[model samples]
Target: MKLLILGGTEFVGRAVVEAALGRGWEVTVFHRGRHAPPAGVRSLHGDRTTGPEGLAALATGSWDAVVDTWSGAPSAVRDAARLLADRVGRYAYVSSRSVYSWPPAAGLAEDGPLVEGSPDAGDVPYAESKMGGELAATAAFGAERTLHVRAGLIIGPYENIGRLPWWLGRVARGGTVLAPGPRSLPLQYVDARDLAEWTLDAVAAGLSGPYNLVSPPGHTTMGELLDACVRVTGADVELRWAEPEAVLAAGLEPWSELPVWLPPGEMYDAMHTADVSRAVAAGLRCRPVEETVADTWAWLESIGGVAPRRPDRPEVGLSPEREADFLAKYDPAGGDR
Candidate 1:
């Protein structure tokens, strides 16, 4: 199989490139040359955001499938899809669950109502950009020939977002850590490698249309995740699990501040609770949380214990002083300290 991946140097894109190579498939990566892609594939240098001149290098390649992970303006996706539409047999766009309308109801599936977007749109919000990318891909490749991978919280090796990396770093610090609660709060996420593998398999099987790509609901609980972190790092850290109300009252946000944690409410339901039955039936499998945590920690350690974060994303995790202050006033056992 011949595959072309745009932005194949980091995160989900990197995972797909590696996965393709692992399957002994011919892979070609079209990236900006910012960071080196994996060693084996053919690499083409270009900046997709810079318009046609930047994409001149990609003018002549043909592949069985093309996977694009662009999260910026829809125009970039539109441009690439149109250029490759004639030569590439299928198009796969790595979209997000965020494309669903705000406050998506629990168990929302691939058919859920989506945010408004356009194929020719310029720079816009994340959700709009993703929806527009979907529109753009479909507009160029047709719905039957385009695959929309609507992914949820993606974490694993090569994670540039710093969610798991932040937790691992904080736990590795060996002190009292502010663990979000309720500890039993469930999480839903997909390992990038797993998503990549499923994507390739789906493409091979000639499947198209949007698939809510993530593990089943409650794939792992907050307690399980943090406990795995504590175990993996072997750091003498105490996970002081705090209540949802107290954590929010402390002015700490859910996803950005704590990372991968949402209080038990509508927001949590929207983010973590989704119906991925279509994907599961299509052969999606997730690794155990322990494996995901352990592998991510090992990857972080390999890269000098610091995760590369995307410039477009805001910083995640709690500040040391802020966590300390919150710990000082709140008692994990029950009441105020």
Candidate 2:
């Protein structure tokens, strides 16, 4: 199968490219030629934002599938879809759970309402722009030829961005760690490889429409998540509850401040849970969490301090007085701390 992937140089796109290549699929990547393509993959260079030159390059080429991970704006996706609708058998657009409206109640499914906005939402336009892009692709190719994979926080090896690695690195150092909220708060993440595998299966099976790519239903709390990090890295870190506002007041930026924290929200309050039964039933199997954690640690070690260790002193276990002080300053209402 010939697969053309847009923005396949890094993160999710790169993971998809790797998975496709492992399956022995002929993969071609379209980007600005900024980064080197993965080994054995051909690279095509052009700017999708400025003109039709990039689309024109693939105008005559036919592919079994096209996975779009880079088109942030709706117009960009619309342009691409118009060009590839007849050229490809299936078109997959990488979207986000951010498209869903805030306050994601438990047990929410893919049929939930979505947020609406333009392609550019200030600094990072990927989420909102992808929402618009999904609409355009669906319109261009129709449901039969299009599939939207709305992914949640993707965690796995080589995650240069601060998702799981940020907290893991912090805890590995053995100090008081600032947790957003309670230990049992909902936390969900999907390994990038798992996502890529499922996406490929979806294309191969000719699955269409929207599907939520998230972890299986289970309770993954803030504490458990941190504890797992500590266990893997052997970092001696203490847990400290800090309100969102207090975290800002202390001049400590939330994880969202980091460029890698794409989905902007408190990990505790921002519940991005979704039901992926449809995708799983269609042959999407996820790796165990332990494997993900081990792989992540291995990748971090391989990088060798690419992620700088925070200079702050290790936070010893919070004392009663400290806990009280933290609650008073951060969570006056005592709401789920």
Candidate 3:
């Protein structure tokens, strides 16, 4: 199959590109030339936000499918979709779960109410921009020809967010580590390779409409995820689980400085626990948590554990001094000096 990918050099986009290539598909990547495409694929230089003139290079060839990872601007998505509407047989637009209304009620599906938007509401907010991109793609490609992937917390090797990698590197430190609790807190994430392979399958099957593209909610717990991290990192660390209230009271942030801990309250309790039965039934297979953790750590090793961590911002996870302080105060055993 011939595939065209927009923004294919980055995390999720790269996942699809590599997946398709591994399957021996002829792939062409259209990007701004900032990063080189993988060795085997063809690259076309263009900016999605630059309108028709920017996309001039893309007018020449046709493909069986197009996987778009562009969410910078809705106008860009609309323009790209319109420009290639006739050239591709199917269009797969990568939309995020954030497009759904924030703090969504528990058990909502893809058909659940989305963030309310005005036709005139500019994409000032990230959620609106993504939803606008979805609207733009569907507007150009039509519902029958477009596929919207509403992905939540996408984790795996190429993740730019540093969530999973933060945990992996922390575990590798091998000490009395601050593990978040209650230990069974559920996490929703899709492995990039898994999402990519499933995307190719959906495109091949000519499936359209929206799919909430993450592992089923409540399918994996906090213990499950952290255990996988420990097993993969092979760190000689002791995971000391602390209650969310204590963690927050101690000044650790959820989901940011502390990677995957979402405290129960109005913020994101429902967001991460969205129902994914539809996605699972649609063949969205997630590899075991251990496998994802192991592979991600392996990839991190290959790259010398470098990631997009900000130099100005101090490293995430607990600073040793802080963790020691917290343990002295919070850990019943008071292991800190």
Best by TM-score: 1
Checking candidate 1 for backbone clashes, the offending pairs are: none
> Which candidate should be chosen as best, given lDDT against the real structure?
1
The order of the candidates by TM-score, greatest first, is 1, 3, 2
Off by over 4 Å in 3: 117-123, 309-318, 333-337
Count of residue pairs whose backbone atoms collide, per candidate: 0, 6, 0
Clash pairs for candidate 3: none
**TM-score attained by model 2:** 0.79
Clashes of 2: 6
Please write out the lDDT profile of model 1 over residues 114-207, one tens digit for every residue. Answer: 9999989999999999999999999999999999999999999989999999999999998999998888888999999999999999999999
Which of the two, 1 or 3, has more TM-score? 1
lDDT tens per residue, model 3, 1-337? 9999998887898999999999999999999997778879999998765566899898789999999986566777877888889888989998888877766877678887787433223445768878888888888888998999988888888667788898898888888888878888887788999999999999998889888888887668888988888998888989889888888888877877787678877655565777888778888888888888888899899989966642333555556788777887885443323
Task: Give the per-residue lDDT of model 2 (tens digit) for 82-136.
Answer: 8888888899998877777766655668888777765323223555777887887
Candidates' RMSD to native: 0.8, 6.2, 2.7
- The reply for model 2, stretches above 4 Å from the true place, is 117-127, 239-270, 307-337
Per-model CA lDDT versus the true structure: 0.94, 0.71, 0.82
